[model samples]
Target: MPFIDIKVIAGVFTPEEKQKMVEEVSEAVIAVEGEALRPVTHVVITETPSGAWAIGGKALTAEDVQTKRAA
Candidate 1:
């Protein structure tokens, strides 16, 4: 049984993207831990409210993330 936790800024990823993330993450774990753990492999995603995430002392909101991604 493996538990994976992922956190990101809110509104940065669409529901479909999150679903893809969960699927890919689970597959990666299965490849390393074997298929038997498929049912037990857990991938949890947490989203912090906009402007709540920070980097290098700078707070980043959802718009900031989009801006950075575009650049």
Candidate 2:
């Protein structure tokens, strides 16, 4: 079985978006690993607490990231 783990800041994506992401990621792996492996390919998406994840030694939440991006 192939295990795929994806981590992201919590609240960064909606439930529907996450589902799409999982499906897309799984499909990508299947394309490379073969169609037979689709049933056995495991994809895990984990969301860490927003402020708990950091960049450049600064802690920030998804909202902060979006606001900054808009600037």
Candidate 3:
């Protein structure tokens, strides 16, 4: 079985978008691993809570992103 894990900050994607990502990721895996492994491919997406995902030693929330975008 093939297992894939994807992680991202919360509020970044809607449910439909996440589903699309799963489908597309599975397709990509199938392309690389061949058609036979398509049925066994698994994709897991994890969403970190807002203000919990950090970079550059700073934790960032969805509000921070919105403020930056407005600037």
Between which residue pairs do clashes occur in model 2?
none
All candidates: TM-score: 0.93, 0.87, 0.82
Model 2 segments more than 4 A misplaced: 68-71
Q: How many residue pairs clash in each candidate?
A: 0, 0, 0
Query: Cα RMSD to native, each candidate?
Result: 0.9, 1.8, 2.6
Predicted candidate 1 versus true structure: per-residue lDDT over 36-65, tens digit per residue: 999999999999999888899999999999
In model 2, what is the error at residue 68, expressed in angstroms? 5.9
In candidate 3, which residue ranges exceed 4 Å CA deviation? 64-71
- Weakest 10 consecutive residues of candidate 1 by summed lDDT: 51-60
Candidate 1 lDDT: 0.93
lDDT of 3 at 46: 91
Cα displacement (angstroms), candidate 1, residue 9, comes to: 0.6
Q: Score each candidate by Cα lDDT.
A: 0.93, 0.90, 0.87
- Residue-by-residue lDDT tens digits, candidate 2, 1-71: 88999997887788998899999999999999999999999999998898998889999899986687579
TM-score of 3: 0.82
